[model samples]
Target chain A: MKKNEVPQDKSNLESVNFKELCYAVDENGEYTTAHSTGWDPKTIALNKAIEEIHERTENAKQRVLNNTTSPIEYYMELHKMDLPILSSYVGFWKWRVKRHFKPKVFNKLPQKTLQKYADVFDISIDKLKNIADGN
Target chain B: MEIKFTHHQSAHCENGVVSNLMKHNGFNISEPMVFGIGSGLLFCYIPFLKVNHAPAITYRSMPGSIFKRFAKRVGIKIKHEKFSNPKDAKVRLDQNLANNNPVGLQVGVYNLEYFPDEYRFHFNAHNLIVYGKENNTYLISDPVMESVTSLSEKQLEKVRFAKGAFAPKGHIYYPTNFPKELNIESAIIKGIKQTCRDMLAPVPIVGVKGIRMVAKLIRKWPKKKGTKVANHYLGQIVRMQEEIGTGGGGFRYIFAAFLQESSKILKNPKLAELSTEMTQIGDLWRDFALDLSRIYKNRSAKEDAYNNVAIQLETIADKEEVFFKALKKAI
Candidate 1:
């Protein structure tokens, strides 16, 4: 891309008002660095990925509200983590983590187990046990 | 105490850190030169490996490999350490700072407060320099940022010990020795040859073949995975290519810059011509990304949008195959 041709489209980066450094060919055909606010294609792709995460988080929240799953599932989705990643952070086996997704199993969990989940999510134990409305 | 570090923003994080650190050590290495000497360019698509719930596609070498390769090839002695606990990591970092040593650190981007929200993710391969610490804040020289920034002690600790795939584990590295003068000519030649080998590797999941494999998967995704999932997959490809500190166009432009610089250093005019060709290929990659985005946005006017983007990728693969072959012959 030419130096002057670098995309400067407004994007989600506008929230932080940051410009990304990019490389382009100057008038002399020499490579140089240019700052890009964003490009349309990248912006769209990022928005789509973020949207997917939000959709999954919302789905998990609904399941928790219906008592189909536990608050662990909701918090995991809220933090953009899948089961394997959550298990690794919480130092639990994959199957054990999956078991905790059940409200019945999660409710019977000890304070230590709840504390591990709370620590990973960087939230309080009381908050981990209860789901806040409109979070 | 500050180590008098000067930050020069670059197109990629690892290259930026290496280049900036080299300059601080009294060597003037450009970012592209650092990237090129490190043989940082590659294309790989791992179907079994998942990142962000999508198949992993990497446009560069593994996280710390660039600096490792670059240092070895350029005859620089370096030291690297990874701590299991943050307490030890903090003590070591403080010791380095007290001695006026600026060290590069591998950290996760998720909790980096200076990063924009849109760019924050669980990626743990981001590199930066910790030049000094004042009270509770660590001075940072993140190469992707326009200016130097700072992170609180707790925030820095959180990112350094971030848990997930490719966890940073409080990693720290710095160059300890350098030759009287760099062998730029041989280093550039070696870098070029390795890149050629990587691009032309025979493995189906690597190099030029890897690019082709992704093209094949793109054709099947819409029919097999449903539109929503396929669109998400396509978005993942573009994000990996353009969004993640690639210097735009999947590090192709940086490689092109490297080639251009090498042409002047090695006195090989053939490399200059190839540099232009590589830039055109980078443009092709950008076009492919734009077309893929159009399909996911439901704005593609073409009847067979998936097939069209797949064809675009195939064309890119074909050009890259021919380009690498010639590049190998040029040196």
Candidate 2:
């Protein structure tokens, strides 16, 4: 790729940070180098990913407040996991997981089950339970 | 203790680490050269595996394979270890630094505090070099960064022991020996042949054919799944292409640069011509990404947008099939 060759009509160099070295080619057809003017298109794409994850987290938080789902759902979404993954991690069947998505079912879950989930998420059981309260 | 090491950032981490390691041993090699010599280019779309709830779509080989294969081809002996205890790992790392050896560390990106908040993710295969340690901080030379940085000992411990898919498990690697001379000709030829074999592998969800498989799956997505799911899938593909490194062309541009350098090293004009073709193909990928982005940003996008993307992907697969076939014989 032509280093520092910004694609047209995509971005401006206004906020660009030209500190990172990027690989370019010299007139000799050999590998040369140039600093990145950080407004590269890849930065835009990365920002989009961050936005998507943020939105998912926010939506999960809203779901917990409405009591439509339990804190387990919120934690799973925060950890970027689906029901299947969470089920396998906790060694519970998918149906058990679906049941656990309810506030009542989750509140009554065994300490062992909560500990398994907390371990998988690398968080304490208290933090896992109080996730909806922004703990 | 600190080792005298120079850092140069690159588009991808593995190739950059390998290139720096080569330079540390007094062999000046570009990241693209290391990438090509390792036969790093690949495509895979495994629906059974999910990354962030979308099917896993990888642009290159498994993590660390590129460096492993490159080191083997260059006849370099490298010491790699994984520790059960972080304390022991820290001791070993400090010992290596005291011996004037820089260590490559595999750590998760999620907990690397130096990274911009927007750029940090749960990726576990991120590679960085630790060259020195102060009272509480360790000097880090992450390939994707603008310059060298530092991390606290506590912060380093968290990332090193990060738990997730492809956990690092306190893994560290450093070169122990280097060949006196390299047979560039044989290495280039072997690299090219291996890349060709990998691209043409018979697996339905791997290699160039894998691109086609994803295209087919995408075409059916809007109908088989709902528009919301299909659009999310489109966003995921673009994410794999542009966000997770190799700069915006899904590694096609980097590989094209590699082919260009290889042509000069091997004195083959055909390879140079093929390198130009590869650049055009890379541009095609960029165009497809641009189109996909429009679909992702527009929730009310027409139903045909998914089909349009599928068509673009199949065209890419067709071009790549011919490109690799020619590459197989170009050597």
How high is each candidate's TM-score?
0.98, 0.88
Relative to the unseen true structure, what is the Cα RMSD of model 2?
3.3
Task: List CA RMSD, all candidates.
Answer: 1.2, 3.3
Interface RMSD of 1: 1.0
- In model 2, the Cα lDDT at residue A35 comes to 52
Candidate 2 error regions (>4 Å): A1-4, A8-48, A66-68, A79-105, A108-128, A131-135
Candidate 1 to truth, TM:
0.98
lDDT of 1 by residue, B1-331 (tens): 6778898888899999999999999999999898999999999998887888899999999999999999999999999999998999999999999999999999998888888776777888999999999887999999988889999999999999988889899999999898999988899999999999999999999999999999999888877988888888999999999984798899999999999999999889999999999999999999999988888887333448888898899999999999999999999
The residue-by-residue lDDT of candidate 2 on B1-331, one tens digit each, is: 6678898888788888888878888998888888888888999887777776578898888999888888888788888999989999889988998888888999988779877555556778999989888776899998877688999988898889776578798999988988898666687788788988988899999888899999898888878887767777777787787553565478777787888888988899999889878877877887898888787676787878878988999999999999999999999
* Overall lDDT per candidate, in order of appearance: 0.91, 0.79
